[model samples]
Target: MVQRFDLAIVGGSFAGLACARSAALRGLKVVVLDAKPDPGARVRTTGIIVKEASDEFDLPAGLMRKVRGVRLYAPDDRALDLSAPGYFFQATDMPGLMHWMADEAARAGATLVYGKKFESGLEYERGVALGDIHAGFLIGADGARSRVAEAFGLGVNRRFLAGLEIECEPLAAVDGRFLHCFADSKLAPGYIAWMVPGVNATQIGLAASRPQRPDLGGLLRRLKAHFDIRDIRVTSRRSGLIPSGGVVHCLGARRVMLVGDAAGMVSPVTGGGIHTALHFGRRAAMLVADHLGDRGIHPVVAMTREAPRYRAKLLLRRLMDLGPPNALINAALMTAPMRRLAQRLYFHSRGEKSESFEAWCKAFEQEPDAKPHLKLLT
Candidate 1:
C-alpha cells in the first residue's frame, strides 16, 4: 500500500521543519523523514539568524541570545565596528527550537518519522522508499549532500566557504552582545574568522575558501591571542560548508523541490543562508499547496520568475566579493553615507519584496557595475 501525502519533506532540520509547519498550517498533509531521532538535528552551525527574519518566522524569543553589534578586525589588527538598531540573536537552544517546530507540525496534523533513510530506484514510481509506500510531492531539505535531489537529477555545483571553530569559555571582557570577526591571509583566505557569542561561552571559528588547505592550529592560536582569550576550556568543535555559488536553478522536478542548503541558497560573501532558506522553505510549501489545487508546481517558474530577487541580492554579494577583502571592508566603512544609501539602492532598489515575474525583469537591471578591485572606497 502506498502511503501518500501532500508533501514529503526530507531532512527535519530548520529548513525541513519550517517547510512542514507551513504546509501543515494550511491543512496540508505532511510527512517529514530524517535519519536522526535526536531533538536537535546537528551542531554544525553557529546558528545566527537576523532579528527581522527570526521574528518573521515566529521563532521563540527565549531561544536567542541577543547581540548588539559587529566588529571586524583586519589582518593588520585595524578594526571597523558597526551597530544596527536592533539586537541579533543566536539560535543556541536548537534542541528546543527543533522540538518546538516538530511539535507544532504534529499538532497541525503532520506525521514525523525518524531514522528513515530515503531510497530511490526502478521499483518505485517517484523512487521513494517508504517500505511499500509512496508520496505525492517530495521536498529535499537535506543538507549539501542530498540523495533526493540527485535522484531527480537536479544537480548542485557549489563553491563552499569552509569554516572551522571551537566553542570555549566566554571571554571575560568580550560582551556577549556582539560578534567579533578576524580577517587576514593567515587564519583564512577569501573568508574570515568569527567569534560568536553564546550563553555561557563563545564559539570561535575560522573559515576559508580553501578548507582542505588551512593551518587550523595556528588559526586557533591567533584567535586566542587576538581576543586575549585565556583559561580556555574547549567545549565543542565544528566544521562545515556553506554554499557560496549563489542560488542555482533546476531545484525541482516532476513532483519534488529543494530548499535551504540543498538548493545552494547561501550568500556569496557572508555565507549566511538561514534567512534565505527560511524564506524559500516557506515558498516550497506554498508551491506544494498550489500544486495540490491543480495550480501545478512551477519549478522554473519560481526560479526564473520569483527567485531573482534573491539572485539580485546575490548579485550584490558577488559584486562585493569582486573587490579584495580589505577593499570590501574599506568600502563598507568609507562609502559616503549617501553612497552607502546608493549601495543599498543600487542593489535592492527594485523593491524589498520582488515577485517571480518582476524578479526576472530586475535581473537585467545593472546599476553598480563590478569595480576593478577593492580600491579605496570610490
Candidate 2:
C-alpha cells in the first residue's frame, strides 16, 4: 500500500522541521523524509537567532545562550563593538534543537521518517517507493546541495565561501561572551575568520573565497599570532560552505516550495541563515497550507513583498566584491554620528535584518565615492 500525506517535506534540518511543525499546527498530514540517521551532525550553521524571531518559532529557551553584542576585528587589530539589543541567542547543542523540533512536529500530527531520501520528478507529486509514501505538495528544506532542487531543474547558482573550522580551548582573549570576527590578508582574501565563544570552548574558523591553494594553516597561524593565542588545545573540527546567491525562481513548480538554504536565503554579508531559515520555513508552511485550500503560492503577497529586499542586499554584496571599496566601508563604520545611527537602525532591523545587509546596501549607495566606508561595510 502506498502511504500518503497532505504535505511531504524533503530534508529534516532546521527549516524542514520548522515547516513540519508549522504545517502540522495548521492541520496538514505532514511527512518529512530525511536520508540521514543523525541529521544534526551535518549542520554547517553557527546557529544564532534574534530574540524577537525566536518567539516566532517557539524555540526551546534552555538550548540557547544570550549574547548581547558582536565585536569585529580588522586586519590591523582595530576593533569595533556593535550592540545587538533585544537579540540574544547562541545555540550550544544544535542537533538537540533539531530533534526537539522533529518531536514537536510529530506530536502535532506529523510523521517524521529518518533514513529515507527524496527523489524529485514531475510525475511524483507525492513520490512513493518501497511503500514509504507520497504527498500533494513537496517542500524542500535541504541544504545547498539539494537533490530536490536539482531534480526539479531549479539549478544552483554562483560560488560561495568555503570554510574550515576547528573547536579549540578558549583563546586567551575569548571571555565566553563575545563573538569576534577577523578580516584581512592573513586569514581570508574576501571572506572572514570568526571566533565564536561557546559555553566551554570556542569555534575558531575561517571562511574564504577559495578554500584551496593558499596556506590555510598559515592563515590559522596568522590568526594565532594576531590574537596572541598560545597553547590552545584542539577539540573538534569541520568544514562547510556558505551560500551567497540570493533567492532563485523555480523553487516552486506546481505544488513545490523551497525553504532555507535550498532556496539560497543566506545573508550576503555574514552568511548567517538560521533566522532566515525559520522565517522562510514559517512562510513556506503557510504557503503550503494555502495550497491545501486549493490556492497557489505565487498569489501570496509575502513572497513578492520580500523579493526586493533580497535583491538590494545581493546588489550591495556584488559591489562590495569590487576592490577599493573597503576603505569607504571602514570610514562609514568608524564615523561617530553614523555609528550611533547604525546601532539604532540595527536594533530595528532584527529578524529579517539581523545581518544589516539591505541597510548596508543603502549606506553604500548614498556615498558611492567613499572608500573608507566600503571597508566597514565589507
**What lDDT does each candidate get?**
0.66, 0.66
- Against the true structure, what is each candidate's TM-score? 0.79, 0.80
Q: Assess candidate 1 and give its lDDT.
A: 0.66
Per-residue lDDT over 65-126 for candidate 2, one digit per residue giving the tens place of the 0 to 100 score: 65555666655566766654235546455667777877888888888889887765453544
Residue pairs in steric clash, candidate 1?
165-205, 305-356, 306-356
Please give the distance, in angstroms, between residue 203's alpha carbon in candidate 2 and its true position after superposition: 0.9
- Model 1 RMSD in Å is 10.2
